[model samples]
Target: MATPLWLAGCVAAPKPSVQATLPPAPPPTLAPVEVEPAAPATQPASLFTLITQGPVSAMLSYSEKVRSLNGNELNAELARLGEPGDVPTAQMQTALALAQTRVPADLARAVGLLQRVAANTSAEARPLHPLARMLAARYLEQRRIEDDRDRQVAQLRDAQRRIDQLNDRIEALRAIERSFARPANGAAAAPASNGAKPAP
Candidate 1:
C-alpha cells in the first residue's frame, strides 16, 4: 500500500533557468547659438519738416513769379504768385528795391510791386504763420540780449561808484596823516648840535 523513496523521485518534475544582457552607451549633447535680424528701409517725413517745407516752397515760387514780372507786370505777376506766405516775401522786397534803381521813373509800378510785398508781409505776420512765429522768437531773444547788456552796464556803474568812494576815503586818510606829521618845533629853531636839545 506505501510508495518507496525511489518511486517518489521518479514522479517529481524539473525547473528552467534564464540569462541577462546590457545595451551599449549613448553619445553626448550640445548647446545652440542665436543671431539678430536686420533693420527696415525708408522712414516717413516729420510733421515739422512738412510744415517748414510748405512755406519754403511757397516763398521760392512767389520769388520766381516776382522776378518774371519785374516792375512792369507787378499786378498780373503778383496775381499769379498768389501769396508770398513768408519765405521770399522780404527777399522779394529787396529784389524790388534793386529793380527800382534800374527804373527810377517806373517808381509807380515799383510801388505797386512793393504793395504786393507789403500784403505778403502783413499776411505772414497775421494769423501767426511759422515764419512769423520764428521772427517773433528771434525778436524776443534780441530784447533779452539788450536787457542783459543794460544790467551789466548798471553793475559796472555801481562798481565805479564803489571805487570812487574808496578813493575818496584814501585821500581823506592821507590828509589827516599829513596834518599830524608836522612837529611843534620849527626847522629854523634847531639846537647848536645836530638833532640835539638845547641846555635848559
Candidate 2:
C-alpha cells in the first residue's frame, strides 16, 4: 500500500482546454444587370387577314382514350366536356338507340358555324373547303329528321287527347239518357189506358 503513491505520481497529467474566435460573415452582394440601349417599337400583327376569312369550325370530337379511374370518372369527364355521359363508351356505342334525347348538344352551333363559313367563302373555295359545306348540310338534314319525329309525336298525343274527350262526351250523353228513362216518384211505367186486351 505504501508503494502505490509513487506509482500514481509517474502517471501523466491532464491537458488544458484551448478556445478559438472568428469574425462574423459579411452580407451577400447581388450582381449588376447589363441592359441594352432602347430600340424602336415593334409593329402589331395584322388580324385583318384572319377576320376576312370564313368562320372557324365548331365540331367537338370525342376521344378514344380510356379514362382509367376508380370510384368515378365523372369529374374527369366534366373537365373535358362540361358534363358527363349517361353511359360509358362501351354501352353508349353498342346501344341500338338512346331512350332519352340528347340535350345541350352543340351540333346546331357547329352547323351554324359551318354554314357561315360556306356562305362567306368564294365559290372556288367551296370545293377546297368541302368539309365545311358538308357539315352544314348534315346538320340541316338532322334538323329535318328531328322535326319529323316531333311532328309524329305531337300527332300521337293529339289523337290520344281526342279519344279521351270523345269518351267523356259519350259518358255525359249516356247519363242524360238514363236520367230521362227513370219514371217520376219511383213509379213504374203506367199500364195502357184502354187496357188494350183486344189487340193481339
Output the number of the lDDT-best candidate. Answer: 1
RMSD of each: 25.0, 18.9
Residue range 62-119, candidate 1, lDDT tens digits: 4454456546577554445454344434434343433423333333443444444434
Largest TM-score belongs to which candidate?
Answer: 2
Identify the runs in model 1 with alpha carbons over 4 angstroms from their true place: 1-128, 184-189, 192-199
Which TM-score value belongs to model 1?
Answer: 0.35
- Poorest lDDT segment (10 consecutive residues) of candidate 1: 38-47
- In model 2, what is the error at residue 15, expressed in angstroms? 84
lDDT of 2 by residue, 1-200 (tens): 85799889888888797777778888888789889533323321112221334212211111122223322453344344432222222122111011112322444544544555555445533442455566457666876788789899999999999999999999999999889878653443344454645446
- The candidate 2 region of ten consecutive residues with least summed lDDT is 91-100
Q: Show how many residue pairs clash in every candidate, following the order shown.
A: 0, 0
Off by over 4 Å in 2: 1-106, 117-128, 189-200
